[model samples]
Target: VTVCCVAADPPAEAWVKGGPVDPNLLGATTRSFLAKVLTSLMDRFEQDDDKDTVAAAGEALAQLAMLLGGPGVHSVTQRLIDTCLQLLQQEHICQSSDDELDGEEDHDGALWEAVSELLM
Candidate 1:
């Protein structure tokens, strides 16, 4: 995951407006690899119980979306918004419950902070 994030950082600017690498820059093989990476990240984001892992996956997803710059950006943006809304709902439920939330709130708060940063 860390490796993927690092690898994506360098090519980010290239995919932006007026840059050399456009949507057509990637070959079939590279596109296939990116698809696999995106799938894996989405899976981790949805299934991971650890808040830190989920937050990292969310950041990676945002980075990958920017690097790809195509129809995928819209889909990924919507997905991230949906995920954040779900997380917010879960946090509300947790707060309303009687269970102890001292540590849980901290974890959720950090995750929310990270997701907020990515969205910005």
Candidate 2:
């Protein structure tokens, strides 16, 4: 019923490592929560014109992608692929150009690297 109830209840092993998550894992509700978190991070990255939040959001997405694994990634279709592709194409764009409004420094390399690593 609560955010804490959902996130904290999920087995930590499923999220901490990107190894093969159990096929018969996560209830429907939990899966939906994962979908929301992934979507929210991607959306946050898009809305956040600032370099810091954008970069942070990207990092969060990358981490989520990692834990989610191949099976876990079935939820996000276009958004995940688009973000990954964008990072591939603009590897150095963020590092060079950024709005420092929120004191979030830019690291183009990290963003690209994070996504790449996630998909790996």
Candidate 3:
């Protein structure tokens, strides 16, 4: 997986949704096409709190799951749940200071909520 779905720089929007490169150009298949695509994209926001990207990731994941139908989707969905939960754990760890923790008061909740909403 490509670490960090996106770089913290200009035109960051490309990391999640629309950008210089269009994902539509690539066809989805059983192989690692979409997985690698989303994996790379999600890896970007993995450490970043940008809830917008997280929400977008959730949507993208759902679409991928649907495309990879049956238990594959369920399996992928479950893995996504695990991944989101892990990210929340990491976010908690990164909140070393009280102020930082307070700042992210609802950050974890919101992130998971978006993921859950997407799954549901």
Model 3 ranges off by over 4 Å: 1-32, 70-79, 86-113
Error of 1 at 115 (Å): 1.5
How far out, in Å, is residue 111 in model 1? Answer: 1.0
Encode model 2's per-residue lDDT on 1-120: one tens digit a residue: 324534655654454454555533654555666666767776766555444566677766665555555445555656667766665675434534554433332354546556666566
lDDT of each residue in 1-120, candidate 3, tens digit only: 211221211221223232223333322333334455655555643544465466566666655544333322332445566666765565523233345455465765655665665555
TM-score of 2: 0.56
TM-score leaderboard ranking: 1, 2, 3
Candidate 2's error at 115, in angstroms?
Answer: 2.3
- Winning candidate number (TM-score): 1
lDDT of each: 0.60, 0.56, 0.47
Tens-place lDDT per residue, model 1, 1-120, is 433533544333345544454434554444556666767887777667667678778777766655555433443556667777767677533233466555876776777875676565
Each candidate's number of clashing pairs is 0, 0, 5
